[model samples]
Target chain A: MPDKFRGNLLALAVMVCLYERPMHPYEIVLTLRQRHKEESVRLNYGSLYAVIASLLKRGLVAVVGVERQGRLPERTVYCLTDSGKEEVHQWMADLISTPTREYPSLAVALTFLPVLSPDEALRLLKERALSLETRLVQGQASLQWVQRHGLPRLLWIEAEFLLRLTEAELQYVRELIGEIEAGTLEGTDFWKALHESQELSLGIILSEKAQYPEETGIRAGGQGTAPRKRTRHG
Target chain B: MPDKFRGNLLALAVMVCLYERPMHPYEIVLTLRQRHKEESVRLNYGSLYAVIASLLKRGLVAVVGVERQGRLPERTVYCLTDSGKEEVHQWMADLISTPTREYPSLAVALTFLPVLSPDEALRLLKERALSLETRLVQGQASLQWVQRHGLPRLLWIEAEFLLRLTEAELQYVRELIGEIEAGTLEGTDFWKALHESQELSLGIILSEKAQYPEETGIRAGGQGTAPRKRTRHG
Candidate 1:
């Protein structure tokens, strides 16, 4: 699905892949790497498989059939559902026609705030919050799901992160509505702050872009897979 | 590429796309929708062709061959180059790795400000700034080549966005160094501002995630994508 799809990128990529051919996880990874390389694809075994499994549950993707071999675990050959195809097309059309805010991949989430009326924005937030809340509860519902699952320890943290964020959105939207109700929002600091926030984000974005000098050729720092030490998961 | 990738989501998505099959413009648009629907990948026809041609020239992607059907224009199949592959991987890897200051995206940029200097932070910013300068030059050269072709009107705006960004970076870097030279930065509003800005941005990010409400579905404002007096593209 294009940007208009209003979902995640890797999920869509996974769908595109499944749509192309029913694929086992390993085969999917293989094809992704082959089309270009693992580096460019920015996919790894851990995140990749996790997203696949999630998609399977969402009904966007499913196991059309299975592939088995002697030694290794039986492989699940997944394919995009009709619903998934519709999601892709619907999103693509949205991209072409909508004048909605352009959401950036990771950090651009904030930019979408002004795109909707506060009510609509609040509704979307609540929707996301509910999903995150479900993930927080239902995901950790069974001890077996948590214990047997070899997800990054941070997987749990992501839900928590979402919970915090939605709570924050709930607060902000309330504040926004309060402002509107009170008629205090007109030319106020919050509005200005909201506006300035865009510049600040842009500034941050621009600054990041600036860090890379145009003249020099690629350096060691410029290449893939800069390793990490985690603090909190988002 | 991960969110940590130096480039934004769209740029990373485009890079990841090259890892797939070689695509002409229409195909690129189709491919993007087919895969990453959330990206809402949109391009004026000019930017699409221009980005592809530059990617080809930069060795990020290679033109394997071209095909011409009866009525349509020629289509060139562009494959990602080795360097492109490496860069993409680096971006992906960095997304989850490389812990630094809290909220590394903006903090990383601010670190370059001389006003914020501690010996270690200064050293980090210097290293980062130096690296950024190199990339900026290369990016500019790439944009220049893009302009050499009959450039699209909006495409130039994108190019200018990049260039102006680079210019801002250079300016900031210089300003920061000067601030370090002057004693004013240490006790200046910058310090307070830094703390406030960080709190705001981080708060916004976290709040959006945690505060966003659960979906109570809603519809549009009765009107569809209809033309209002000066609706979209205004």
Candidate 2:
């Protein structure tokens, strides 16, 4: 409920593995890799031990046993304490059931895209379309590989999600390129005019800076006074 | 081209705005908000200035003019340097055209799911399904709002992407729940067995630690064993 343990994927992973069975640190590493979980959860042995030590400090796990197998180093196994079990369960519940904000870079780029010249924007978008198409093909092949290996669909749902997302993005980008080519994009005129006017305005400002050097003291750009005029809010 | 300036959304937004024309810091803030670009890019005035100062330092943007408007603080206008224009265009090109690795938290969550009990996992998946459905409805309403406001589909493609993703996730979770209920999931049996055996093994480990404290000196687990077992590669 405190949500303090959020986003610590390594801790989540260690707890998850310990919940399955008490494991020595070495066994935990071996098991995670054997199951291909290393792809999702980082599997640094040093970090794994640190997490275990923290878990012990928190009383989330306790030393269960030690094994001396044919001169191998003493392997101290760990198992989840009652609190550890509860922690992992609640953490997973929070992660799965909640829809938190994710800031995708592509989303951000698209939001500010009107800055580019339409022709340039179109050419770039076509490039994007081609890239997305290539990715879709790669994703499809990867999905096929997963399927061929006979991994559970549930286990590889992430791949499926990604493939579907790539497909959707490819379709959307293609449609957008078509709209730009047909001159049907809603903001095209505004975007183009914004670029043209800004270029001219820059010329004026550059000359002004040259004429009055004292007025243009560079303190910082973002610290500006609020406009006295009420600007429309989104 | 080295993809150095990729994913800095604030810098991208600032550069994009300056690309249109020279703008004082306050004007940039106002225009970003007015255009609803704030929804995607963070609009913190302090960070905006920091980005601007960095841009100036890097010679990406230059001071064009200074304005003293009606008792307001002296406002320094900024315009993209020739290099700034090229940087923004190339950054956008990389962002749109390259499919960079995005590590979504949900993908990570799915990877370690075997730790949860089947019933508990099913319950959580159902909860997620419900949340996704709620989000889908809200996303639909937001899309309708954007459509009614007459914003271009191109501008609001992110909303569309989000909606589509939500729908896809809902469908996947529901299907996953069905697989769990029907006992048709590929790894459910293995997961259940792992949990049962691990719980039993922990009982033994706890008792062993009690009986033989000497063997388990436990100077924090994992400071044990050979320095050289070649760990398999991921």
Candidate 3:
């Protein structure tokens, strides 16, 4: 099997590869594809150029050298900057770090619970469904492209994997609408959560305890300090 | 339990809140704490500023309206732009369509088979461990600060949850090193597959492969192609 980087991780992978030897962009692409393992990392010039520019801007990488073949286009090669090297070093040190976040949309959606009406939340859910549908269309298109392009076996994995996740959300949303319609779930934490999400402010979030006095009070509906003491740790 | 935004979805939470009301940085912070349930979203200035700025730059959000809020201490209220509203709409729609990726650093790290020499790979792993350690340390510090400041219900779930994840990764990395040394685990594909990582460029990888074609042939390790028409699609 081969190594892979996903999304932003591509930057780090590029850093890792550059650490070994300076590489031209075309060389970089060809090298990645030849490994057969890096199909996802395999990028067109637009994406690659964008990343390279971003890396230079971030001071994580630089143009170490460039080369031109007799009749071929001039090639610009890139390498890790000291900062880039340090970043890679730091990232390696953090390899054992835990998987912290859940998902982008879900994480963000929960925050604005307070301000939005229940109807609005439902509306948002529906909109997300539409986005997923778009993605599905895109995924299917890519799948066809890959098969037709004579791409190797793994090309479909990402598209398929992403689709599976999308499908799960689609089903969950349908189930959610059902819960809403049936009135089996209502007038509860869901509403409050939305409120709290709406309420997020720097002062309030950092001074969480001070602001959330309502939650701690007997009336706020949660059991008190028992859970609190434990998180106070070394 | 509140109908927690499924997976602590932060982006949706923030976007929705902003759509309903444009809050100055500090106000947004205050709300998240006050509104937290057993589990809730956490947003700090750095991240908050970044997202808001990005949104504003992209025209997804506008300073459509602002509040004076007494300028001895300056503050600008943020309201979503019309486009921002559309974006939030689309964001929700997308969420409904996709599956969320979990924390998979170790898995992602493993994707770059043979890209890094054993030493370089080990170095990369160490960096990851360190980065996790730093975040854990920062999160704990924040947790303590919030606890002392008297937050509501001390909504500690997020910091604690993140801490545990980081701890898990540290342990996973140690085990990974052992597996590598034992030679019981070899092949880039295994790491790539497990991690759902992106692939490396074939140029550098192919050169390495060509060095030892006997070990890798037409099927060529984990490149995007199906191995022997293996029918991997689900």
Q: Give the best candidate by TM-score.
A: 2
TM-score, chain A, candidate 2: 0.66
Order of the predicted models by DockQ, top scorer first:
2, 3, 1
In candidate 1, stretches whose alpha carbon ends up further than 4 angstroms from where it belongs are A1-7, A37-41, A95-234, B1-234
Model 1 lDDT tens row, A26-128: 7766554332212112456777788877777767787878766777688878887888766744543332222222232222232222322334433544444
Candidate 3 fnat reads: 0.13
**Predicted model 3 interface RMSD:** 10.7
Cα lDDT tens digits for candidate 3, A1-234: 012322465566677667667887666655555443353343456777787777888777888767776877777889877778667655544442333343234433433322344566667666656655666565566556545544432223333433444455555555555555554443334444544564434233233334333423222112222323112201
B57-156, model 2: which lDDT tens digit per residue? 8898999988886886888989988999889878877677665555556766776566566777888888878777766776676566656756556566
Better of 1 and 2 by DockQ: 2
Each candidate's DockQ score against the native complex?
Answer: 0.03, 0.22, 0.12
Q: What TM-score against the true fold does each predicted structure earn?
A: 0.25, 0.69, 0.48
Better of 2 and 3 by lDDT: 2
lDDT of 1 at B140: 65
Model 1: docking quality category: incorrect
Q: What lDDT is obtained when candidate 3 is compared to the true structure?
A: 0.49
Pairs that collide, model 2: A21-B198, A64-B205, A198-B20, A198-B21
Q: What is the TM-score of each candidate's chain B when compared with the real chain B?
A: 0.36, 0.72, 0.45
User: How would you order the candidates by TM-score, starting with the best?
Assistant: 2, 3, 1
Task: Give the alpha-carbon lDDT of every model.
Answer: 0.42, 0.65, 0.49
